[model samples]
Target: MIPRFNDHAANERTYLAWVRTAIAVMAFGFLVERFDLFITYASQNASRAAHKLHMHLRLTEWVGLLLIVFGALIILLASARFLRNRRDIAHERMEDYAGPVGEKLLAAILVLLGLFLVVYVGQELAALSSQPDM
Candidate 1:
């Protein structure tokens, strides 16, 4: 069996890496959402002729918020997985190697995540289509 310390260290490092990625994703999501919101507010206070432009800006802000929410969800799931995987690796028993339930679960989760992303993109596209042309 692999040594516990080595495996634990590796697992911790992997978890930390994932955490970093999650932070980046969340930060970028926030930036996108915030910038869009600023544009929306600015356009809203402008002249009446810019009403259509304001509508488009509002739509864009909504899209940005959706992206932020998606990213946040992804980060939450990824962090949970990383912690679970680290725990499994750190305390792995002989029986765990045989059935590998954790690995299987992780695989299942990844598949679900992919499906979620696909559905999310599709929904966003549908929403975009419902918007009036600007």
Candidate 2:
């Protein structure tokens, strides 16, 4: 039987969870980055004057790209953590995670993204409501 099989299994499970999260984040980023397509399609039928209106989500583009970058970073971080955790599990006493910086950074970025999206959406709604009907 493998020694400390439960600990090893738990470590593997945690690593897998991180991988899943990373994939999800990347996928969501791709979706957000593609918002440009929707905007273009929407503007296709708009009057020439409407075309001049500023309706683009420039910040959203940056956020989406950042998310994709973060997702890749997550994979790297998870792999490093998994390896370290595995090594620690082999010792008589496991040491604390050296710097937890990656996870903390990810959390902080996500929170900022969430807040930006909220404010962006709210502002867009207000602008839409204020505009005169076409």
Top TM-score prediction, candidate number: 2
Question: Each candidate: what lDDT?
Answer: 0.59, 0.77
Q: 49-73, model 2: which lDDT tens digit per residue?
A: 4533344556567778988988898
Best by lDDT: 2
Clashing pairs in 2: none
Candidate 1 — what's its lDDT? 0.59
In candidate 1, list every pair of residues with a backbone clash. Answer: none
Candidate 1 lDDT by residue in tens digits, 12-84: 7866765675566556556655655554554444433456555655655665566566556656766786677
Q: Where in model 1 is the C-alpha error above 4 Å? A: 1-3, 37-49, 94-134
